[model samples]
Target: MAEVVEISDPGDPRLADYRDLRDVELRKHLEAEHGLFLAEGAKVVRRAVEAGHDARSFLMAPRWLDGLADVLERSDGPCFVLSEEMIEQVTGFHVHRGALASLRRQQLPPVDDVLAGARSVLVLEDIVDHTNVGAIFRSGAALGFDAVLLAPRCADPLYRRSIKVGMGAVFSTPWTRLPDWYDALPELSRRGFTTVALTLSEDSVPIEEAVAGVGRLALVLGSEGHGLSPRWEASADRRAIIPMAAGIDSLNVAAATAVACYAAARR
Candidate 1:
């Protein structure tokens, strides 16, 4: 079982990592310098445990410990037991789920390794919203996509709000952030994967036609409001659009992802 330590003082150095409820700088610093990601709520903490993330510490209400006893038993780290009021004070918000963990981030395998045996993959470009990212993961997992890739501006999948929004699917899905979007498409084609960009351009073929011919495929989804930029049209092997009602121009990015994922899986 993980050792449960009682903490009351907000200024205690032992709780340095968990202190300051609204310290965005601190969170980013921890991620950039320490390579730790925050996993919040019972659901995400459970997922992180199941995914084998190296847990460093837990901050939670004393009563919440019982709910995580099994997870705690497997966690080889300190669990800080605080009162509900103390937790609120520590986090600067009401964390209704009552448990949060700090986990060491694991290194992802090379993109080739991720795509080696995969038939379908989703590539996201500059998806800045955490909610959208989470929704996409839920849809991707349910629709049977093999893995997900994020472009540089995509929100961190391990962010607390994203974990909650994704219902822990972020941990279940295989994901890695690709630094260079320009090289990704060509590299994927060289690996025997056709690249399909999701857009509503005039030249775009119906999604069914694009899905019909591809074997190993990378389905690219762009930012929610802007859609795919002009440069991607020439780079991708095919452009696809989901047909909608007479008046409806397009679905939300997350909704489009669900539809695209379903189409890709059937291919």
Candidate 2:
């Protein structure tokens, strides 16, 4: 069983793992330096542990302890119990759901390993927003996509906000970053996945038609502001667009992924 240590000092060195979480750049640096990521809220914390991630440590208010008793029993890391006020002071924001765990980040599987036996996949390019990445992961998991492939520059899907927003779907989904972005689409084609990029080029076809009858499918999405790059738009096996009602031309990238993944699943 995990040892429970009661702490009152917000500046305690033991609380370093839970500090300044609202500062994105600082959290990124610290989490990468420590090779760890955080799981927030009771459900996300439970899911992280259940998915086989090892806890570096846990921070929670006294009220949240009993609810996570089963998780604590399985974890070897110490649980730092604190008042909700002190928890907010240490973490830099109010943790309403009350439980947080800093979990060791495991090595990423190679691209081929993530794609093995994957009939449907999501390919993301330069999506800088953590929320969109999280939402996309959730959509992919809910709709039964096999895996996710991120371009080298995409946002970290394992970030705390991403994990919370995705409701821990990243843990369940197999994903890895592409080593080479320039030839990514061609490589997917070589691996037997028809690369269908969601774009609005003049010749782009409907998403439903683009994915229809394809044996293996890779649904590609791009960034929020600019959409797909010219090179990527042209390199894909096919370009597709969700036909919109008269005024609106497109959806947000996250919303677009859900629709596209839904379409791909039906194929």
Candidate 3:
């Protein structure tokens, strides 16, 4: 069972894990150094704990304790009870969901392990937005894709904003970073998955046609400003584009993932 400790100081060292969340680079380094990730909101925290992530600690106001009592009771870690203002001071945001947990990150399964028995998957290449990464995971999970593969430089799906935006789908979805960016699409092809690159290439076919009749498929999407890298685009087995109105060039990456995943689910 967890012990509840009341803290009045924002400078408390015990609260170190939850500090300065808005500082992206600093948080990344700190989280990496500590092997931890923060899950915000009551539901996301519950999901993270339920998904077998061990909690390092929990921070929340007194009012949130009852709502998360069952979870806290199961944890051996400390629960830091603080005033709302103190929490705001430590975390640098208004935690509307009223609970935040710093949980241990486990080793990600290998690419092959995530791909085993997966018929449909989404491949992301250097997508930098946490929201897009989370949204893509949610779409892929909801629309019947079996897994997700991220390029080495893609945003961390376990980032707090991503986790909140994804509604904890990142915890449920099977995913891992590709070990080799240059041969990622080729490697998928070697595993018998038809690699479909979502881009605006001249030879691109409609998304439906690109995925039609394929038993094993890997749908690849790229970063926000620039699309897929030349190596990835050129190496893909098929190029696909989601048709839009005459004037519009493309949809946002998250929107594109939803549309493509919906089409792939039907295929």
What TM-score do all the candidates reach, one by one? 0.92, 0.98, 0.98
lDDT of 2 by residue, 64-103 (tens): 9999999999999999999999999999999989999999
Superposition error at 68 for model 1 (Å):
1.2
Q: Mind giving the per-residue lDDT tens digits that candidate 1 earns over 1-267?
A: 678999887555666566553576677676768787778888789898888998889988877888899999998889998888887877788888889888888887677666667888888887877888888888888888878888777777776667778888878877887868777777777878898999987779878888996888899888877887676656888999998889986899988889888887887
Alpha-carbon local distance difference test for all models = 0.82, 0.94, 0.94
> What would the per-residue lDDT of candidate 3 be over residues 148-250, giving only the tens digit for each residue?
9999999999999999999999999899989999998998999999999999999999999999999999999999999999999999999999999999768
Model 3: pairs clashing at backbone N, Cα or C within 3 Å:
none
lDDT of 3 at 264: 94
Provide backbone clash counts, one per model: 0, 0, 0
RMSD over all Cα atoms, model 3:
0.9
